[model samples]
Structures are given as C-alpha cells and as structure tokens.
Target: MMVAIAQERDRAAFARLFAHFAPKLKAYGMRAGADPHTAEEIAQEAMVAVWRKAASFNPAKASVSTWLFTIVRNKRIDMLRREGRPDLREEDFLHLEQPVETQDETYEANETGAVLADRIAGLPDDQALVIKKAFYEDKSHRAIAEELGLPLGTVKSRIRLALTRLKTTLPDS
Candidate 1:
C-alpha cells in the first residue's frame, strides 16, 4: 500500500493508510500530553506529510507505524514552536536564581566525583561500559543494547550490578 502510494500516487492507498493511522496518531499525541484539538491537528498534519513525503519512507529503517508516529511527533513540536511562549509575569522568574557554590563545597564535589570514577573503572569491563553509556553518555538501556549488539536484559543487568557495586563502595556523606 505504501509502495503503491509512493510509486503510483494512488489516492486509494493513501486513503486506507490515513484511515488506519490518523486516529491512532491522534491518540498517541494525546498520550504525549497534547490536548484533543492539538492532537487532531497533529494527526491531520502527519497525514498530510505522509501524502507529501511517502517516497522518503524506508521499510528497512522503520515500520509504517513508526514512520507515521515520528511524523506526528515532529508536527507536534513544530506546532508548539510556532505557538511560542505563553504570557509571562514577574512570578515566573521567582525561582530563577541559584545560590552560588562555596569553594570548599565545589572542591569536595570534585573529589567525590574522582573517587566515583575510579570505583567505576574497577568494575568488570562489561559492567563499567554499560554504566558509562547509561549515565555519562545518557543512553537508554535499549540504545546501549542496540549499539553493543547485546540483549536488553543483559544491558539492564549490567547497569543494576554496577549501581549496586558503586553504592557499596562509596562512603556515606
């Protein structure tokens, strides 16, 4: 059906695709915190993009549902950006100021961090690698699994073990 729409520009194929995905996309947007009206707009915009950009879709990279949902997500972000900031008042800035850190406090933080890094280095290579990817590099367990060609459960287990080891080794402040 997608191939038909992309290669032949078949309206029938597009109609069927839109019918199947539009409501699901709207529900997805709502679940992502969009109001009903915004969710509807997101669904419409995603369908329009599918009609326009169908040729760019690659089955090997993502399934049709994934592609459609990605389009909906992008459309929602664009709409939010265009909407711009809401009206702001003085109260909005009340919590903006952060207390300055003392020199001794900053030095203690750096020492603690160095000790933690050393402890992490002492872990088994697999556990250390997963811990660094999950925390320092801010990658999800699923992403780490994909990148390392490991199972998700293995990635998660390594992180859990690394955290337990770190907790035991680190002294309480």
Candidate 2:
C-alpha cells in the first residue's frame, strides 16, 4: 500500500497509511517522552518521510510499521532538539548589535575558531573521531556505531569521554 503511494502517487493509499499510523506514531512519541505538540510534529514528519522515501521500501526487508516508527523516532529527536535550541544570531558570536565596522574583528574570530580546532585535534584519536562524527558530521550515535561496527555503548563512552576532555581542556568562557 505504501509502495503504491510512492510509485503511483496514490492518495487513497497514503490516506490509509496516515489513518493507520499517525496516531500510533504520535502515541509512540509520547511514550518516548515527547510532549503532545512534539508528538504531533513527529507523526506529521514521519508520514511525510513515508511519502517521500516510500520508493525505497521493500516489503521483503521490513514492514511499513518498522520503517515508519524508525522515521518517527528520528523525527522526534529532530523536532525536540529544534524546539529546545536557541536561535543563533550573528550578534551572539560577534558580540555586536549591528554589522561590524572592522575587519580585525573577523580575523580575531577566525583565530579563535582555529584555537578551538587545535584543541579538538589534541584529543585522543577515538575521542576526536566521535566528536567529529557527532558534531561536525551531524550523525547520531547509533549511526556512528553502525558505520564503525562498534557497540553502541562504546560509541557513547567515547563521546562522553571526549566531551569531558574538551570541557577540561577549553578555558571556561
């Protein structure tokens, strides 16, 4: 049914998929510790993902529910992170209310960023790899673990240890 929607743009199949799974996805998000609004967002995003990525679905590998709940889980994380995230403004970094009048300020900013990069480079290889993958590459810990074929706990431990090292190494700001 979902594959039909993907390949043929079948609204009825999509409707059926939405009717069956949106509520369940919402409930799953709530059980996973999201509030109602976030749960609704996750359900909505997951359904959209089902529509967009359904062509990739293969019934032989996994059922629609398996595929969809996976999408829901990821969507929940993304939505909650966004809701809690601060809006990053240029002023927040440059410490200026308006456009900079000096190029020296830009140079200083780049130099400070370089120093931070040096500190990251100083971490142990395992710790630095996890930090880069998680922050720079923007991959989930589970994705990192699978890519590296390491246990999830090992990946998490590396990230935690790396963070602790960074916290101690970087001067308090």
Candidate 3:
C-alpha cells in the first residue's frame, strides 16, 4: 500500500493510510501528554510528512507501522517542544553553515599574508615602526605620535605612506 502511494501517488492508498494511522497517532500524542488540539495537529502533520516522504520509505529496513510510528513520535516531540519553546524561529534553523575551508582559499590567505609581511618588513624604519604600532599593536595615531615624541601629522603621514607602499608593492594573488 505504501509502495502504491510512492509509485502511483494514489489518493486512495493515502486515504487508507490516513484512516489507519491518523487516529492512532492522535491517541499516541495525547498519551504522550499533548493537549487535544495539539494532538490533532501532530497527527495531521505526521500524515502530511508521510504522504510527502512516501517515496523514501524502504520496506527492507523497517516495517510500515514501525516507520510510521517513528514519524508520529517525532511529530509529537516537535509539538511538545513548540509548546515549551515559544521563542524558537523556523527560519533560524532553515540554513546550516558549512564550516569546511577550501584548499584554494587557505593557500591564497597564506600567500597573501607572507607577501604582506615581507612588504611591511621592506618599509623604512621610521614608517615601519609607526605602522606596526598603529596596526599590529592597535595604537591610535595620536597615541603613536605621543609615545614616539613625534607630531601627530608625522605619525599619520608615516602610516599612510607605509600603507600605499605595501598596497603597490604586494603581489596580487
């Protein structure tokens, strides 16, 4: 019967399935402590999922009842959690992040970083020291000038010149 629904999308087969399982699912939800209306919704949701996922059902793995009750069981848990977690957003869970880094991106980052380091090293000592304080040490331009006993404009100029030289000198990968 499930195979009929999967192969043919037979409405009669679906109707028979619903007739057999819907009430039982509802009763199961209620026994699991969902309210009456929630139990009804759970049964309907489980049946819809079964109808849509019918093609995925494999008799080789599980009996029809076992597979179906599993759906009902999951739906019941979802309903229970829904009641408990009113703040849950469906959209928040719709997309999952792929955390794997591609080989190309990793290689490019390492190469670019090495080029940047070499470029910074090639800068004049005064410019390189100011740039290092402003960027690497996260010092403000005024603070860098005060600490080095130089004028603010001189510190800013050094940083600007250092950046322009690095940008023009670094190899674009």
Reference-based TM-score, model 3: 0.47
lDDT of 2: 0.67
lDDT of 1 by residue, 1-173 (tens): 77788899999978877776788778766765678998898899989888888787654444465456456656766775566444432111222122322333224434655777799889999999888666434367899999999998988888889999887643342
Give every collision pair in model 3.
none
In model 3, the Cα lDDT at residue 126 comes to 98
Q: Model 2: what TM-score?
A: 0.46
Q: List the candidate 1 regions with Cα displacement exceeding 4 Å.
A: 82-173
- Alpha-carbon shift of residue 34 in model 3 (angstroms): 1.2
- Which residue pairs in candidate 2 collide? none
Q: Give the lDDT of residue 33 in candidate 3.
A: 67
Per-candidate local distance difference test: 0.68, 0.67, 0.69
- All candidates: TM-score: 0.47, 0.46, 0.47
Candidate 3 error regions (>4 Å):
82-173
Name the lDDT value of residue 151 in candidate 2.
Answer: 99
